[model samples]
Target: MTGKTHIVGGIAASLAYAQIGNHDPLIMLGAGIIGALLPDICHGGSKIGRKLPLLSKLINMLFGHRTLTHSLLFLVIVAWLLNSFIPNEAVKAGILAGMVSHYLLDMATKNGIKLLFPIQMTVRFPLTTKTGSKVESIVFSLLTLVSFYYGFESLGYYL
Candidate 1:
């Protein structure tokens, strides 16, 4: 999936989670965006990676794309760190939700992801699509619609 797709997925995931948990949607929005793009830091060409080139290069060199960052180990460490550092429940939950959405979206791609890591096992959905392809565009559209729906729903707008 592309960065835009991940971003929309993050928004949709975060809003849905916020609504379900009765959290503040506003707080979740920004955190969700950050978390969604965090996993792609291993790819130097990613949105977050472009912003932090040196760190991106280092991570990519050390672990390669979709290796360490996309793994459960990274999620565990991030969860621990967020729990320790972030006092806002909404922010933490939003970030984690967004990251999970990222994992799910990437898993739908043909390249898949190393969810288990160290084990070298690739995890993906039964159906997959090429990154940035027409199928991905449709997925992006669906996520956008979901985001809009959740966005309004979280704001107490029932339409």
Candidate 2:
């Protein structure tokens, strides 16, 4: 998943969390952005991957993509970490949002994501899309459109 996809995916996750968590949309959006990219921290091909390519590659090589990062166990730990030290609910929300978004986008790929990792379960949508596929471009585009629309709506409501 590219940065664009991560951003859109994050927005969607954040939006869902915002709705579910009943937090401010902006705060949730930030959370979503973080959530979207958090998983790839362990992948070398990803944006955050290059900075720590060796660690990312090592993780990917050892566990494979989506195995560890996509797991609920990891998410729970992440949430706990946020809740314990992050001070604000909004920041915690972002971490969770980013975590979920990371999982969801990987699910969109042809390889799919093992969201239930270590359990040997593969989680993917029925539709198989190549990572960075044309379909992903559209998905990201739509996410952007929806995000912008929502942003404008939010501005109107707030202003």
Candidate 3:
């Protein structure tokens, strides 16, 4: 999936977290976006990778794309870090949700992700689509709608 789609998914995940946890919308959104982009840091050509080229290149050389970063181990470590250091439960929830959403979306791609890394297992949905294709566009659109709907629902809590 494209970064745009991941971003939308991040926002939607954050909005859901906000609604559930009564979190600060901006903080959740920011953290969620970071979470969503974190996995692709291994891919030097990816959007986040382009921004942080050196680090991305190092990661790409070391672990390669869709390896450690896309794995459940990575998510567990992130969640552990968030839970250990971040006192704000809502922000932590938002980030975790965003990260999980990233993996879930990637699972829909033709090249499935290694959800359980080091275990040598790739997980994917039955309906796989190519990245940057029409199916991805539809996914992006649907995520946008979900983001708006949940964002409004989150705002309702403020009102």
Maximum-TM-score candidate: 1
- Tell me the spans in candidate 2 whose CA falls farther than 4 Å from its real position: 19-22, 156-158
Per-model TM-score versus the true fold: 0.96, 0.85, 0.93
Residues 38-143 of candidate 1: C-alpha lDDT, one tens digit per residue: 9999988999999999999999999899989998999999999999998999999989989999999999998999999978999999999999999999999999
| lDDT, candidate 2, at 96 | 83
TM-score of 1: 0.96
Tens-digit lDDT track of model 3 for 55-119: 99998898888889999999999999988899987778878888988999999998989898987
| Candidate 2 overall lDDT versus native | 0.77
Badly placed stretches (over 4 Å) of model 1 are: 157-159
lDDT of 2 at 70: 78
Task: Rank all candidate structures by their lDDT, best first, as comma-separated numbers.
Answer: 1, 3, 2
Candidate 1 least-lDDT 10 residues: 150-159
Alpha carbon lDDT of each predicted model: 0.92, 0.77, 0.88
Q: For model 1, what is the error of residue 90's alpha carbon versus the real structure, in angstroms, after optimal superposition?
A: 0.8
